[model samples]
Target: MMLLRYLSQIGKYFLMWKEIFNKQTKWPVMKNLIYKEIDDLIIGSLGIVAFISFFVGGVVSIQTALNLNNPLIPKYLIGFATRQSVILEFAPTFISIIMAGKMGSFITSSIGTMRVTEQIDALEVMGVNSLNYLVFPKIIALLLYPFLIGISMFLGILGGWMAAVYGGFTSSIEFINGAQMEFNPFHITYAFIKTLIFAMLLATIPSFHGYYMKGGALEVGKASTVSFVWTSVTIILINYIITHMLLGS
Candidate 1:
């Protein structure tokens, strides 16, 4: 029974995906909508993302420093580990999971509210492609999601440097050298690829839950919670798969 329910929901989600591009909204309207979404979803999220990235990066560096009890171990490893952690996983995967809660709930509640108020029905009656109007802009806006991950990467490394140097774990020069040492450009490519994929999931999955949810105001909140759980789970699953395919031997 549970399996059937899950499969049915998956089918519905794909159907919504198809409908998003059908009878597309006009370019001018869509352009404005895209701008609105970019403001609401992307620009609005910058502060929290920056704060979390900086603090977490510092934590990563401090933890690495503390774990090295052996005097023989190089202090530079602190920066190396922090750089690898932030660029490879913390910025992309961890921050995405955070967004699954912040942005995901916002999308779900906003759309679910529209559904409850008959706004979506009204749109349909007016021959408007509500899915395209609502969901497509979000998808387009999130194309810049990689930009957030880029900021996160920079701030995270910066935080690590500050924490390590101020905490006396390592000198600034040594830590910078470690951060630069053996840095593979591909790691960044991999992170942004994951960011792009996660961005798609972030935009679509919440919209799915909200668009299809039943009942009234209460159900909107319920759908938001379920959407968050599912989005986070899906992100984690995809992260594992991407990492395995890209890095696993």
Candidate 2:
């Protein structure tokens, strides 16, 4: 009986997602929600992403160089490996993980706070479709965040190049050549698509959990923690699925 009830609830939530996408009801107030989420994701994440990406590139370059000693492995393969790893895997995956920590926690806490404070209730009383007004904007904002992170990832590659040259892992020209040789437009596209899907799940799931939070302040904290854990797990699982299904490697 309990399992049946749980299945029924899942069905209802699925329908809610369908309804949201279908625009069965108007939700003009999603604009503010979108902006709020953008501020939290894009604007708020800038500094941390910049710092992390720069170091990540540097570390990856250094490590890759340390691992290769065979003449059979061309020195330029470092660049190829770096480019592929950064674009298709490291950049997108790591950035999403960071975002799950930063933006995910923010969404959970904010929404949970609103729930605890009755602000969500107030919005309800005002005839706002809380889901549409709150959730939609966040979803849109997170979708955009991944593209920004993609750009950041590119810059990070450049940072890695600089670090590699300075650290004597590879010459500047060799690094650039490796990157160019490995460049694949399809891989870049795949990364972007994956990031977008990740962003959607990252934003929506946390916000959903937070929005319905009950109890009190402590419960809000719990929701935030759960949001981070679930978002990270979902991101990793989804990334594997997409990588195998779409990229076929």
lDDT of each: 0.97, 0.80
Which digits, one per residue and each the tens of the lDDT, describe model 2 over residues 1-249?
Answer: 999975774585566566456432254456665677788788888888888888888778878888887767767766777787788888889888888888888888988999999998997798766777677777778767766777777777877787788888778888888888947799888888888888887778788778767899999989999889878988999999999998785
User: Which stretches of candidate 1 lie above 4 Å from their native place?
Assistant: none
Candidate 1, residue 65: lDDT: 96
Best by lDDT: 1
lDDT of 1 by residue, 51-142 (tens): 99999999999999999989999988998999999999999999999999999999999999999999999999999999998999999999
TM-score of each predicted structure versus truth: 0.99, 0.90
Model 2 ranges with Cα > 4 A deviation: 1-13, 19-29
Going through the candidates in order, what is the number of backbone clashes in each? 0, 0
